[model samples]
Target: MILTVTLNTALDITYRTAALIPHTTHRVTEVVERPGGKGLNVARVLSALGHETVVTGFAGGRTGDVLRELLGAGATARPADGRHGRRGRPRPVDALLPISGSTRRTIAVVDTATGDTTQLNEPGPTVSAAEWTAFLSCYDRLVPGAEAVALCGSLPPGIHVGAYAELIRRARAAGVPVLLDTSGEPLRRGVAARPDLVKPNADELALLTGSRDPLRAAHDTRRRGAHAVIASLGPDGILAATPDGLWRAAPPAPARGNPTGAGDSAVAGILSGLVERLPWPTRLSRAVALSTATVLSPVAGEFDATAYEELLPRIRVTEHPAP
Candidate 1:
């Protein structure tokens, strides 16, 4: 089973309008809501990919209740037919702990005309000391059973900056392969904990290494401590630097649509590959294909199955000279 941790879970609400105009109200065309957070998003993709996945983190108040309900409701929304491979063990299990503060909500307003998204994310609920302790206890139990663990997303208010680092250490001690996807100081500290893998987008990579060069930045991140670094380069695809080798994986063409959960999908791909013991090149191909397919999907935390299957074998994974 794969374990995913989403400390600051959210209710992701999406609004669709014909076009977004400044200082003008527009008619809403559609609305969609889903349980979200980087880790939860990864869990959704992993579960869809037929991996037994478990999700744990913080959930409280009305919003938290709603988040858990949505998460649970969509748990088994997978194909029973042989399509997209065999079904995983009944979707992602919600193991979120309760807290005093209400969970946060994120709004994504999509312009149907331009296909652009304007996101408004609220500051997540502040976690208390007691809540943090409870989370640690929950995490401890889940780690032992996980084939791999993904520690993802931003830290909520009142949590220590080194939270991911601490989690990484615990996962490592259990001999579980761990992947981290976050940014800022939490990411810095988490990387130093030497996770099995780290997935950072282009902007985060540039910020972390102070270099705009993807190859150089990936190398620097590995030096700082990650055993492997898969830097997402958006439409250009992803660059991977691992002990096995370095490779650049990209689809033949750029995918167009909402790119919201592309990175999380990539995380799922890599995690699935890790658990299945696939080679680095094959893993990179899956990551790139899944990420691109997510961009072609209409909403976040989901991907187009047809796009995924069509793009999977076509993704190019070419080795790069060591830096």
Candidate 2:
């Protein structure tokens, strides 16, 4: 089973309207709520891919309770009538630990007319030192049984910047491959822990390495201790630098829709491939296809299975000599 850690879990609410105008009151057309956070998003995608995934993180208060209920309701996998070459069903399980601080809420306002999304995020509740220790204990128990673990998203208040680093070290000690996905100092420190893989977007790469060149930035991240670095280049696709080799995976065409959760879907793809023992090129191909499919999805944190299946074989993964 795949284990995912989302330290700052959120109740994601999406508000849809015909259009968004500045300084104008608008009537909402629809509201959709889901359990979210980077890791949860990854777990959702993994479940859709027919993987059994366990999610652990912080959840408390009314919002947290609602989040847990939504997650417990379970995800419905795409019908497997031999359409995607797989017949397995989705099984996503939640194993969140309680905390004193209430979980956060993220709001995304989607303008249907222009297909644009505006997001407003809240800084999550402050975690006490005791809560952190409790989470670590829980994580240790979960790690041993996991085929792979993903340490994802922002570090909530009261949590140390080196939190991901510590988790990475523990996962590594347990011989579980860990994927680190975050930004800023947490990612910087996490890389030093030498995770099995790290996924950063172009901006995060530049912020961490001070280089705009993706290949250079990826190499720098690898040198900093990540076994592999995959930098998302938006519509350009993903650039991966790994011990096996360097490769660029791109979609047949740029997909246009809500871009939220695309990176998490890519993380799901990579972890799915890693657990399945797929080669680097094929893994990247899956990441690219999944990410593109996420962009085509109307809702965040979900993907269009048809788009993913159609784009999977068409994704171009070209190898390049390691720089």
lDDT of each: 0.90, 0.91
Report the poorest 10 consecutive residues by lDDT, candidate 2: 76-85
Clash pairs detected, candidate 1 = none
Inter-residue clash pairs, candidate 2: none
TM-score of candidate 1 to 2 decimals: 0.94
- Local accuracy of candidate 1 as per-residue lDDT tens digits, 163-190: 9999999999999999999999999999
Off by over 4 Å in 1: 75-89
In Å, residue 306's CA in model 1 sits off its true spot by 1.0
Poorly placed runs, candidate 2 (over 4 Å): 75-88
**Which candidate leads in lDDT?**
2
Residues 98-206 of candidate 2 have per-residue lDDT tens digits of 9888999998898878868888998899999999999999999999999999999999999999999999999999999999999999999999999999999999999
What is the Cα-based TM-score of model 2? 0.95
